[model samples]
Target: MSLPRNLCHGTLDEIVERGGLTEVTGADGGPYLELVSSAFPGGQAPVGEARVFTGDSIAKVVYVGLAVPQIGLDSHMVFAFCPADVAVPHFTLDSVQGQGTYAFHLDLIPRADLGTHLPYLDWAHTPLDATYEEVESRPGLMKTAIGPRQFAMMSPWMLVHRAEDEAFRGISDAVKAYLDHWFSLVEAGVPAEVVADVADTDLAARDARNRTNVFSPDVDKVWAQVERLIGHEQTEAVRGLLLDNCPPEVSA
Candidate 1:
């Protein structure tokens, strides 16, 4: 079977184009895509990294790709970050393909407590719920493989499933629908005055929550491998960009 390169890059292209995001150079003087040669065990192949875009809406993206020969370990992660002021959900798509099995975890993660934020949930949650149900009703799709801790960061509409041939088209359609809905949220974002009214403590807590999600143990394991291959400085640079370390004061 041919490699499903489109599963990663094609989706990213659609996101950038639809969102009208512009490409920007990352702090490392590269276009967000760093070549990490030591990412694979035994230094077999260089991982292709691409930031894709960092737009005026304060949305940032990172794409990591690895294809190891013979062992058939091909994986990709596309993480999209929105600023705290936007109060919109951040997007994450993680997929691993190996030995004729495909695993997927895709969601628009909420930055705050979904249960308490009725307005936010009202604005975004319903569509996600409908989509999740539609996908769940399909045959041969396994439930999402996430634990309770991870579940806390996700909205009620997250899609986590495993499948063989059936997964490819189903996941592609879900990605398109979810992203279109998210782009609408970006388009109809809160007014500046409303954003200004948001309490500092609220913003700080949101930042903390986002950081916790990004710096999870699973993420750390991946970083450790990258650090071992690329060294501390480069690894930290990638982490900072992905997590967006800019202080709220500075951002404002």
Candidate 2:
């Protein structure tokens, strides 16, 4: 299996094991399964698949993958968001293999603004500093060209880069370290001092806006590529699921 697939499925399994989450049914009142398109306009088979689960501390765990192996485009993404009541950072990963190049973005999306929340920043992200620096300094892991606005939505510790095969394979340890640290935070909960007087409603509102902006096409151009393969409607449908907002298509 490719690294992206392995890491995606593996981390998903771990999340389910710990969270005991149940998949949320679609309007069909059945399991959520989607076949986005049989093939792209160019005749290559394209798959835009999603599975969403929710329960316990996790409000939603969204897994979406798009693949057109004929063109060497395979992107697997996962976002495990905690309920609004808690200030724990959400887990996220986007691993991609495009036209002989390997790239991945990994981070724990912040629920509180790291710049102002010193305790939260130190508790949630500072531990990963060494690992982040190590991976950033790796010889073949060159930084991806991300806009400043998109970077603001994620943490400073996010690992996003294009890598040579060796560097790509070498990232496993760093990925493990990040995941393990996150699992610990989930189990231990954020220090009370970190959340402090922040209201749960405020956290919920900020998270809603953050989720929407993080995936907005204005900040992230990758949605354009997805729209090209899956069409605008299906692309928005997927976005709707990620945002935990309304479905794009629904009856009154």
Candidate 3:
């Protein structure tokens, strides 16, 4: 009955199956990265599970689900980071349902600077304009304010909003469209002209810096909540897991 949870799980399964992704076991020798806490004031414990995968074209794929039903909070997020060899944008989706509130964030995180790489922008993002506009126009959905710096890190085509239950569920089609487009980009490989002179090391370095900025506490306030729920140590571990990839670290 929870649309966000269902969508996240389904997407995770499909990607792992079709992409030939290999699941990475946690430090506990468990299959998933788990977090549990009883930090809530009313004795409510929040439980979270994070699944990580790796594949040839994708450096890392993370699906995280957290819920504290007593407080009416539930969130699901999926992030697919592209390999350094290609300049394809990373795919991300976030869906949340809370008491009297529903929200989601969908975006393709760019690997190159879109402002300067006009061709890359066109090739990776232009096709989503129609779908973005359509989703924006849906009834009972309204923009959820995000910081300017956060916006600068993500693509202009991102769909982030709060919506009614009906409007929230209506996004399944748009999610599918975006996922299909991303998959195609990964499969077809990046056009050489789109990133003509950039070396693989440079691309990897850029991606690392970008991920740091995007997930930093200053840029994403949600980390505070996560830390509270899972403790500071575990929270940082999760962040590191999300940021870490198969690419060798580019030397300074």
Candidate 4:
């Protein structure tokens, strides 16, 4: 399938322009990024390997790749981790398009109770209200496709949908708006001393949430194919790099 060009890379470039980022290498001995995957036929290598970006207020890792025409796989992921003590939400965006359909999930995942935090919720969600309203008004567009297990990790502002061309542009616009909002929150994040006191608790909670939501049963489906292409050891390494979030060998 012919997908949108530079959609994910271009967005990341905008974020990079907002602040300086230090590059981190991956286990593959290359830049901690993969431009494309060579594991499958016609995979076209990912836009690049997974890249990690860190700044004062936030740290992010992103991966963008075209579909494996052989198995119908195409997707991009962005996972941004904020200072633990900041009390702000973490950002998660996953976009998958293939087989004549698309699934997009974007959220400012709450670290604690969203219901009790009206001010933060309002600040985070109000910007996308119009976009949400438009999406909800459409038929068969808005969805709860994240599955029940991952629902608790999402905020009320979460956008999960099966988008069509009519709704795609609006969704994309909302993504950009949300990204800007998240960057602002990162810039105005809590002090480092506060983060130091709560770093352990915060990171533990984030890791637990990621283990539940980011590492899904569905991932095994993809891994089945990956193992066949790359073999067991390489597949395990890739899975660890992509889904584990905080590997034990590395300090958080």
Candidate 5:
């Protein structure tokens, strides 16, 4: 299998602008953000977008348009919020979903395939939210509020404008598809491959996710679990690499 790849902000920005926004709106009917459209459009080409806060905890979104030279287009980004503590009354953990964002960052995935992302956030994941999906009824670009999440998992608006080449789009699409399918599978209680396909270039990024990405953390702990997992290989010299990079305590 081809080694896992880490995508950059620059590549995604070009393609999305080329693909253009299919639709935009606020999912599940809230005033926090908006969704753009491309899912099932009137035209043969497909597109889609939705924007919301990064999570319920904060109002400001992370920086966007990283792919683009100037910044994102004149639109606010959508964020997949996971609230550790549930909000009160109005949106309950069970009733209305006041806690988590109930979101998934779909990189290389196509707009039409959004349905594929749903399973991971379904009833079983409940307070896990993945609930309250809404979008704009028209055409426009969109973005996600990412907090050191998988580079592919996010759909930053600027990335839409930046990913101009076919290769970049192909890669971006591939990553997005992987994330959607992977996240959905995990939500379904299936085994998840949240491990990173690492390299020297992305060493810092990989470490960042291990540090803050909600889904996964700590290379040694994660690797220990993987080692305990059924019949795995120690390719890429990861064990040695971790020893060289991590603190002695973590390495031990």
Candidate 6:
């Protein structure tokens, strides 16, 4: 896919002067079509890392990429969501084509150690075919032919081709609206019986179990002791109190 027309780059100095990487804003106060990075973490090359081009552009994330700009000698660059670990690539015009489109993948800390280009790699990925093991840090750490993996530790960071509106910012408002409606229904005295639902699923139990999957056996036992100290019924009662504090207007 092609790049956004508004996409533009400034020198490291210019970005530093302008308050670093940020979502572009128009006079009307709109959201970002894409965010920009003027500085990388730990000071790695800001224009040449492959991980920057391969990761997701939205959500809680960190990535690396090869950044290209006009006016300088062409070179392999590194850019990231965090401070750089090395110098960003200064490339010739001939080598700048489609450099921004490359994606970030898992890697290591770069040779440099400060300013905007710190190398950050993904934790690990679950395998296509694996058996899940019950552990403490997670409730189900899957074992693969290659190694141990956890779905909780995995995030697919593929980008959408240009023109995929939802991938950028299309459906966020709609999802929020739908959630508001669900909360409203529950609060409106609409009996879940009329809604044809049985007992609310034990989402907390499931979540607690998942949290244990990554822990060592000793740590898991320790966490269990801590939970017992808190008492299960009291925890549920606290959750109920939280639910009761909901706003009357939205969840009505």
lDDT of each candidate versus the true structure = 0.66, 0.80, 0.82, 0.59, 0.24, 0.23
Global lDDT of model 4: 0.59
Per-residue lDDT of model 1, residues 1-252, tens digit only: 333456767777777776777666556556554556655457635555656566655467766665655456567777777775567777778777767777777788876566665555667667777778888888878785557766666666888788667665567888778888887877788645434434333854676666667666464466775566556776666666666634211111
The regions of model 4 sitting more than 4 angstroms off are 1-5, 26-30, 33-48, 64-66, 138-144, 190-213, 216-239, 242-252
TM-score of 5: 0.21
109-175 per-residue lDDT for model 4 (tens digits): 7665546545555655566687667666876475845455456656767887877765654566767
The true-structure Cα RMSD of candidate 6 reads 21.4
Candidate number that wins on TM-score, 1 or 4:
1
Worst 10 residues of 5 by lDDT: 88-97
Number of the top candidate by lDDT? 3
Identify the runs in model 5 with alpha carbons over 4 angstroms from their true place: 1-30, 33-76, 81-162, 165-172, 190-252
Candidate 5, lDDT over the whole model: 0.24
> Which candidate order results from sorting by lDDT in descending order?
3, 2, 1, 4, 5, 6
Say which candidate scores most in TM-score.
3
Q: In model 3, how large is the Cα lDDT of residue 225? A: 82
Model 3 lDDT at residue 91: 90
Using alpha carbons, what is the TM-score of model 1? 0.79
Among residues 3 or more apart in sequence or in different chains, the pairs in candidate 2 whose N, CA or C atoms overlap within 3 Å are: none
**Steric clash count of candidate 5:** 46
Give Cα distance to truth, residue 79, candidate 6, Å. 29
Candidate 5 per-residue C-alpha lDDT over 13-127 given as tens digits, one digit per residue, 9 for 90 to 100 = 3223332322222344432222222222342221112221222222112111101112121211222221222111011000000121111133221111123344322322233
Candidate 6 matches the true fold with a TM-score of: 0.20
Candidate 1 residue runs with Cα over 4 Å from true position: 1-4, 25-31, 38-44, 191-201, 218-236, 245-252
- For candidate 2, write residues 1-252 as lDDT tens digits: 777788777888888778898776666764364646644464534375777787767778888887777678888888888876688888988888899899989999988877677777889899999999888888998899998889999999999999898888788788789989988888887677776834433887898899889989988999998887777887887788888533233332
